[model samples]
Target chain A: MKEERKKIILILLISIFMLSFCLLPVIYMVIISLSKNPDFLSAEKTLRFTLKNYFDVLSVRSLHFTDYLKNSIAVSTISAALSVFIAALAAYSITRLNLPGKVILLFFVLVVSMFPQISLVGWLFKLMAELGWINTYPALILPYIGWILPLSLWILVSYFSQLPKELDKQALIDGCSRWQILFKVLFPVALPGLFSTFLLAFIFAFNEFMFALMLTADHKARTIPVGIALFQGLHGEIPWGNIMSAATIATLPVIILTIVFQKRIVQGLTRGAVKG
Target chain B: MLPKGTEKSKELIEAYSFISPLLLFILLFIFVPVVGTIVTSWFKATTFLSEKFIFFENYRLLFKDVNFWQSAQFTFLFILVSVPIELFLGILFALVLNCTIPLRGLLRVCVLIPWAIPAAISARIWELIYNYNYGLLNFLFMKLGIIPKPINWLGTSLGAFFSLIIADVWKTTSFVAIILLAGLQVIPEELYAQAQVDRADFLQRFYRVTLPLLKPAIIVVLLFRTIDALRVFDLIYVITSGGPGGTTTSLSLYAYKYFVGGDFGYGSALSVILFLIAFFMSIVYVKLAGFSKEIA
Candidate 1:
């Protein structure tokens, strides 16, 4: 009983530490966003709550916060949906069809995923410039599809492999073509896997920085990460209140997705990174 | 039913078509660009200057550049310092998380929040927290009497390095934890029960059973974190911008500077070097993990 009590206390203490460690910066961001002055933590200042920061971040036209947010959502959505679809088809081929060198293809894709983004950005910049696609949605979206495809492929392949071959055989006996069997049969059964893959891919695409930084020149294609990173004041000083509010707004979608689909996200992550 | 030869050929054609779109995207965007970067590195590619062939010149110049060496050193040190700490904290969190604790779901959601949000955004928060005058660190330290004055977190070489490390660890430890937790979950309960029956204590069971079982997962996290850390651009780019006389400039940021300056030749060379380092690490990881056997 004493040992069990000690163990419980230890776990509780670690849990508290973990919570505070993970949450303090986020909490500070929210508090600063709400405060009238970002210097509220200093001795000379006191906390004065206000919604004006959020108001300005949303309404101020010059800041172009809304434009960046909209672009991020659209680009991430398209990229995630497209990549997940492509990955699903490829996964179906690898898992169901008689694809040669399946292991080699998977391993090659894994290595491709590990290639540093910087190594690709220089030529991509020149290529986009040549194609006159810089500062457009396609500039970001196309690379994002390629960038996110490997993980999506890996996760879906694992998920699809678990499923019984009888399902495919049954659909084949029902006179469905390969495409129909995939779209009509496999997709419905793999909806949860597909959804989680989409979620992770969306987060990956949305959180992307280097490519978005290089490819997008302005709010026309700039995502939230780049926007928040480059948020500045009209004058010489840093506008902490506005930046924090923008960050808070930026983090909401991902946070909500994380909290609500926590289990699905965990499952997808492990499946991608660990075979077990 | 098994297909006849003609039908088998048709099935093969269909499978190739299914995977073609993926192959096309990856080849065009990832493979071709990496090749382009390598080819460009052997030239004098720049915006203002006319493009010219200058094989090995950019790399030769890189070998003699002081800033390049500084950034390369910083990148290596960052990986060495950060990956281990992240792994340690991650294991602790994973162990706590894996236990039958109350509010486990909430704890997990909290942990995932850090990993979920963009590192660039989180670095902005860290930048504010490290502020000298009104930043949370200064305020808290002063209140607790931990220091007599505010430390310039991002204004000095050592200070900026540690600041980036702390922020990177905060953003990534959750990722490491989650991966390690997956490893922890797979450990059979029967082994622990047997250990307990043999008069083992908690720490003893961990050392004898858990550590050995978790080795592969630990190695996976190690290599993953190392490769990710090797390309440490976003956090440092946001927080310090490699300040204090370029003390914290990562290899990626260094290469980015050259690119921004229209020195694509040198920039591509720098990136190629980073790519090779990461490539070498991934090769080591693949061999160590024995992924071939797993996939087979």
Candidate 2:
């Protein structure tokens, strides 16, 4: 009985350690975000709290916090939607139709996915400049879609392949056209896969920083990650309070999306990774 | 849906139509840029705007560049140190998470929270933690009487390097844990039970049964992580900006600087080298995983 009790205590201690290790930075950010004093140490000693930093970050004219938030949302959502649509069409054609070189094509996707964006960004910058797309939504959105399409394709292809083939036969016998069967039959049944792919893509695009940073010059197209990283205080001071508040706000959407779609996200991510 | 009597050309056309949008985008955005990087690496830029075909000069310059060599060396050192540490921590966490415990679901979610947040944001949060004056580390250390003065975590070369690793490990170790946990679930309980029937202890059974089975998963995690770590940029860019006298600049960061300097030729060469390293590493991982499978 004593041995069992000791084992339980040890496990509990380790669990607590792991939990704190994972959560302390975020907890610290939250504390600093809500503190009245900019100095976290001072604030901890005093035990005072306020929401002023949040308000200031949102309302300050030069901060451009709202613009950053809007740009992040718009770029993430549109790119995710575009990637899902384009990738789903390709996945369907590969898995359902009699396409040649499917393996080579999938391999191509994997290789391209692994290609570092640092190499690609130079040419991308030149292209966007030629098209006069600097500081425009398409500049960032196009690259994001291209970057994330492989992941979405892999997830949707695996999901689609697992689906029963009998449904397709039935739809064909029902005299539905190819597009009709795809749009009306397979799509509705594949909503969960589609939804999961969308979530994963959205989170990735939202989290992407390098392309957003390099591609955009002003607040017009800057994302939350780049904006929050580059957040400047008047007179070139680092405003810890406002920075923490903005960081907290920047993280909220991805966190909430993750929690809400936890299972599907895990499944989509792992299924592609392990199986591939 | 193409009808039972459809010609092969018609079916091929249908498939082509379905795949054209993504194929076109990838060809334009991904493939073209890759080819461009390779081609541009062979040329020399006379000015920022003009270039000349100077085969092998960029590669030669990159090979001789002291900063590029240092960045490459540091990147390898970072990977060699960090990946193993991450794997060890990940396995421990996965082992704990695999056990039947209270609040298991909640713990899993909490562990994921770190990985879910963007690296840029996480780096910023850690920057606060590492602040010399009013940071959490300094405060906690001072409270515990560990040091007379607070340590400047990102203000020294050694401190900055390890600080970047700590932030990265914190953000990414959970992903490794998750992948390993998925691998753990596939491990049948009967193997453990069988080992127990022979009066084997926990460690003995772990060595005898668990490690061998988890090899493939470990390889997958290692490959993904090593490649990802090799190309790490934003974390370093945000945390130290490769500072403390340029001690933490990674290969990607080095490439990015040249890209920003309008020296596209050298930047492309640097990135090409980075890609080659990652590609070779993946091949090594694949061979290792395959060899282990044969032994098993």
- Look at candidate 2 and give me any clashing residue pairs: none
Judge candidate 1 at residue B250 and give its lDDT.
98
Q: What TM-score, over all chains together, does every model reach?
A: 0.99, 0.95
For model 2, residues B1-296, the per-residue Cα lDDT tens digits are 46666767777889889999999888888889878888888887523567888888999998899999889988998999889989998998898889899999888888888888988889899988998888888888888899878899999989999999999999998888888888899999999989978987667888999899998888888888888899899899999998988889999999999888888888989988998887677666645544222210
Q: How does model 1 score by TM-score? A: 0.99
**Recovery fraction of native interface contacts for candidate 2:** 0.59
Q: Write the per-residue lDDT of candidate 1 for residues A33-55, one digit (tens) a residue.
A: 99898988777777999999999
Instruction: Judging by lDDT against the true structure, name the best candidate.
Output: 1
What lDDT score is found at residue B222 in candidate 1?
93
TM-score of chain B of each: 0.97, 0.92
Instruction: Give Cα distance to truth, residue A235, candidate 1, Å.
Output: 1.0
Supply candidate 2's per-residue lDDT for B295.
11
Model 2 regions more than 4 Å off: A1-7, A42-47, B1-5, B46-48, B283-296
- C-alpha displacement of B118 in model 2, angstroms? 1.1
TM-score of chain B of 2: 0.92
RMSD to truth, every model: 1.2, 2.8
